[model samples]
Target chain A: MNTKELIKANNDKRKLLTKETQKYYEDMLIYIRLSYDKSEHETEEILTEMLDHLLEAQEDGKTAVDVFGENPKQYADDIIGELPKIVTKKRIKYMGMGILYFLAALAILSALFNVVEHYLLDLNELTYKIYLGTQIANLMIAIPIAFLQLIVILHYLRWETFKNINKVLAFFIYWIFGLTSIGLFFVIIYFMPSFGPLIEWNVWFNLIIGVVLYVLARSVKSFI
Target chain B: MSLRTQLLKGILEGCILAVIEKQVVYGYELSLKLQHFGLEVSEGSIYPVLLRLQKENLIKGKMKKSPSGPNRKYYYLTDEGQEALEDFRHNWEWVKQPVDQLLDRRDNL
Candidate 1:
């Protein structure tokens, strides 16, 4: 079966597992499934087989812990050791989509602010020129930083080693990081030399670009 | 790990290859086959070995519609797997005799 099919079958089959067993199994499941650079298709194939095997073992009175041994992470690592990595084509596709999506979000937010100020507050800056530095800050510094952060976050989530931290504390950590990145964005833009060719921020045009890019990102997700 | 499990780690792939050589098997069924033949490890342990064998091109898996429940991934021996099994047999014969002779507690008794 294909990767998506295997994943669907896996989700459906996992309902057969007991709650505690499922908890343990799914922790390993999500961890393995999101692991960086792993082959998507092969990983799903094996994970599906793993769920099936675990269910079969459960029939024989074995829990996930029993079937996978005490260290489920170690077992998962062993299995992951042999799975192939994603091809370069898919990797490039994701990276491209990420860049476009990031740009689209910035444009959309700027459009919203412009629209609100002009139409609602009667401010006449709807067609004001956008600074070139903002574009560079976003594309050069912010986009790359966001993608790097995404990679790290995905890695951390899959590791799940943060279970020792309190849930509230983890949320706070994420919140603080979000604030820090935003702070960094402003700091960079402030220091950016504001001299460049005039680039107008036409609200209607940006909104259209944002919608087009939003559509593009959605379509890009359907590629793989 | 016990010395027994440590030793099994090296040879388990061969044992699994031997099992698949006999007939097509899925992960769970292969684990049961190993248990039936007296290997007392976790049933999940076979998956790593299966993955490794597949990586080495010794075996390949196919998704099949099982008679009951989920679509099981069934594995069968490849041409390389058959050759590897034969080599394992030869190597087992060669290695087993001397190890058996050395480890035979009956002689000490």
Candidate 2:
């Protein structure tokens, strides 16, 4: 056969094998995908290469098991096993970074809480001296929320859609979320009078600092 | 794994590098050449090795237009790969004598 005809025949055979071995291929692909953090293009390349080999085996009158060995899953596992060690190493690096980001986020949140408390809470000298207990209580409430926000930001960092987004648009999205978080903080503090006591603000000075810190701490790019 | 399969796995990297060292080829063509030389390897099995080689900077792949289909990733050895092949040749010579002697003794037994 000429090259073109051979190509067509190979493609036809591939289509037939794909129909017959759909579940088999899916099982292997799913295993690989879950086991690695490979990009979609890399994943597709692997699948295509494997399918081509399977088609060639079929053309040679050998079954999939004959070419891929008795257990195709084992073959797939062996292939993954032989992959560069850097894959797991890179994952560990990301995990380390995630932990560091989490700790840094907690530190910033604690500092913000201290600043807000110092400026806003109405306390006499005795209560102010004992404010450590209140600070710890505030931290108990704030840490979990801060951790949840860190997770959300980390998730967005790995998001494929965001990677494909325009840089300017992504920057705008981060600003929007940052501004919204600051606004939400303001609303919560403004309504504090009905639930408890109103906070004393030094006009716009404390508000400006609070908003700046909140935005910096909560920005998606900070965690990324 | 069977002893033969284990042996194939060990030598496959050198064999692939040797092939690409001789000529620039894509995955499918490389697999065909390896099979033609009586190595009983699956066509797809070469890719993981290729990926590792590329990762280590021992080989590089370039996308080139093909006559009958989409662009294909053609591989060629880097300078590092040439050095690796030379090392393999020296090691193979050192290994061949002992391995042959062992097989010869086993046959006599």
Candidate 3:
């Protein structure tokens, strides 16, 4: 199966597992899936294979721990160690997709706020604001913070997963980190004082740029 | 690690390649074949070894629809795998004699 099909089969087969087995297998699933350097195809392939094996074993009254062994983390790591790494060309495509997505997201968010604030004011109060400062601050602070948050949350999930912790608990833990990450973003950031003289960033201008960039970002995603 | 632990991994790699040479098999079926021959190791350990074999290009896996309808990955040996099994047989021939003689004398004692 291709990587996407493998993922679907893995998810479908996982439902056959007992609740306890599903808990353990999904942890291995997250740990293996979230690992940065592994080949995506092989990773998903192995994950599907593992789920199939676990399901069959469960039919005979075995748990995931029984099928994979007691030291689940080591078993997973050993399997991961054998799979190929993502090659450089594909890695570059992955990064390109990520960069476009974030750039589009920040622009769209800024445009949204600008439109909402403009509508809230009376025409007398509707003054043009140069968002050059906000845009620059977003690139400087927001991107890095968002990237850092992604890494931290993925790492946290992987770490928690390697233990006996289940998915429901891991998800709630991620929610707390997510809220804290956004809160951290707003509190520490200061605008760059609207320094760029060339860009007007009027309400419609922001809206247009946001839409165009979002389209560009999504096309990049489809290209990848 | 104990002698069995140290040697089983290396020996299992050869046996796995040999089995794949004989017939196309999935992970569980291959595990059953090994056990039928008295290897008696945990079934889970087969996957890591199969992964290593695939990485080395001694075996290649393809997803095939099983009789039961799920797509299962089946493994078959490459040309390189046939050569590897031959080399393993050659190595085993000499290793077996000395080890057997030593064990045979030890049993006499």
Candidate 4:
């Protein structure tokens, strides 16, 4: 048969192909055509290779659709379905990572609290040092704030809202963390007058904390 | 095509050019030619290859209005395409000669 006839036959068969399979064939063809100059025999070989990938895509799509059924929308909604297990596993991983992130922040904050008391305030030496109780107070407040930051980050990453909306939420979370940290810092200083001129290192440390909170909040947003 | 598919793309182009050399054809028409021989390539699959061939100045296409939806683009081999086809045809002969000869020698042995 002539080339036109051959092409017609191939196209007719192609018309019966499923959408996912057709997409696979189209993608493979695009790559093949773009990458190299090929011969007719080679073209046939590429088509065969594409046929394999198409079959694979068809199988995968079929399995996914079958397991998930039609409207298994959210991960929670699909708990009864087979595919929800995978989504559940991923969600669990995200939750674990988020908890770890906040815990790390709290751990650092707790350590810094102790350091500020010993180095910045003469708590043992002065009467105002009575308010040294505020360091533990800061830790108590920070633990919950850290949890909120994690959620905000997760929301951003998940694309639950428009990306810009998530970003705004992340910004607010950081602002709260930053202002609170600063407020706590100055509150300690306000009560303890003997606390020396704020050290260059302390200012830098606070700035670093602000930046870390900003980054953590943004990073979590992407994860959500 | 497997990993060896890269070797066939040029050959596919040569084949398409050879086919178009005989007649002006649309994208669908060319795909039909591949299919008739049991090659099983899809209809939309050939357009990108056609576009690449045209970009290399090997084939030229013109738009023709159809009674259906959109204008159909038909491609024909240019002089440059013919020259490339001839060159590919020559290289193909040389490449196949050794393989054919080996096969023949094996049969005799």
Q: Which candidate is the best by lDDT?
A: 1
**Tens-digit per-residue lDDT, A35-115, candidate 3:** 888899988888887888887777778777777888878888888888899988878877777766777776678667766
lDDT of 1: 0.83
Q: Estimate each model's TM-score.
A: 0.91, 0.51, 0.86, 0.34
Between the candidate structures 3 and 4, which one is better when assessed by DockQ?
3
For the predicted complex of model 3, DockQ is: 0.69
**Candidate 2 residue runs with Cα over 4 Å from true position:** A1-16, A38-41, A55-63, A84-224, B1-6, B105-109
- How do the residues A79-176 of candidate 4 rate in per-residue lDDT, one tens digit apiece? 11111122454455555555556655655664466566767884422112233345445545656666675455544443432123566877886688
lDDT of 2 at A7: 42
Sorted by TM-score (best first), the order is 1, 3, 2, 4
lDDT of 1 by residue, B47-104 (tens): 8888888888999999888878557889999999999889988989999988898899
- Top-down DockQ ranking: 1, 3, 2, 4
Candidate 2: the clashing residue pairs are none
Q: Tell me the tens digit of each residue's lDDT in model 3 across B1-109.
A: 6998778788999999888888898887787799899988777899888888888999999999888787889998899998999998999997998798887855663
DockQ of each: 0.80, 0.15, 0.69, 0.01
Candidate 4, what DockQ?
A: 0.01
Reference contacts reproduced by model 3: 0.60
Docking class of 2: incorrect
**How does each model score on lDDT?**
0.83, 0.63, 0.79, 0.53
Residue A169 lDDT, candidate 4, scale 0-100: 76
* lDDT minimum window of 10 residues, candidate 4 chain B: B39-48
